[model samples]
Target: MNIAKNMEAIFVAAIVIASATSFATAAVSTPVIAVKAEASAMQTVTVTAKRLTAAEKAAL
Candidate 1:
């Protein structure tokens, strides 16, 4: 395959641009991921109340 010199340059530029975009995307999404993780963790606990005992259930 005969690749021109400018084609090599263009390929290099495209790789650099893709790398930069990947880094930018990772940086921007990190905090969003953290926030989502926190929200999911928070949601994991339905409530803090303890399960009612048989006696407690009878009292109700």
Candidate 2:
């Protein structure tokens, strides 16, 4: 019974450690990935102009 309790404690500890490490890895890697995604997802706008003709200006 004592050996079974020790085994259960060890198993729970191992699971907790594994979950902590997985979360730590994700926290470290998420920012770099988010920066790359934001850079790629960015967009730009362009503007252009043209001079109006005399007839069109007179009509207006």
Candidate 3:
């Protein structure tokens, strides 16, 4: 039983690592559309987000 549990833990870890690397490589290798100023005239953009409170930070 101990050996079985150890093997399971190792297998789970391997799968997690494999999935992580696959996703990382997929994102890096894919060609994605890019924004251009002349084509879309989206020269300037502003982004805003809500600030988290101290309690939220502590919870995380």
Ranking by lDDT: 3, 2, 1
Clash totals for all models, in order? Answer: 0, 0, 0
Best by lDDT: 3
Model 1: residue 46 alpha-carbon error in angstroms: 42
lDDT values for all models: 0.79, 0.83, 0.86
Instruction: List model 3 lDDT by residue over 3-50, tens digit each.
Output: 875998899999999999998988886588896567566577688989
Task: Give the TM-score comparing model 2 with the true structure, all chains together.
Answer: 0.41
Q: Flag the better candidate by lDDT, 1 or 3.
A: 3
Name the regions of candidate 1 deviating beyond 4 angstroms.
Answer: 1-3, 30-60
TM-score of each: 0.41, 0.41, 0.41
The weakest ten consecutive residues by lDDT in model 1 span: 29-38
Judged by lDDT against the true structure, how good is candidate 2?
0.83
TM-score of 1: 0.41
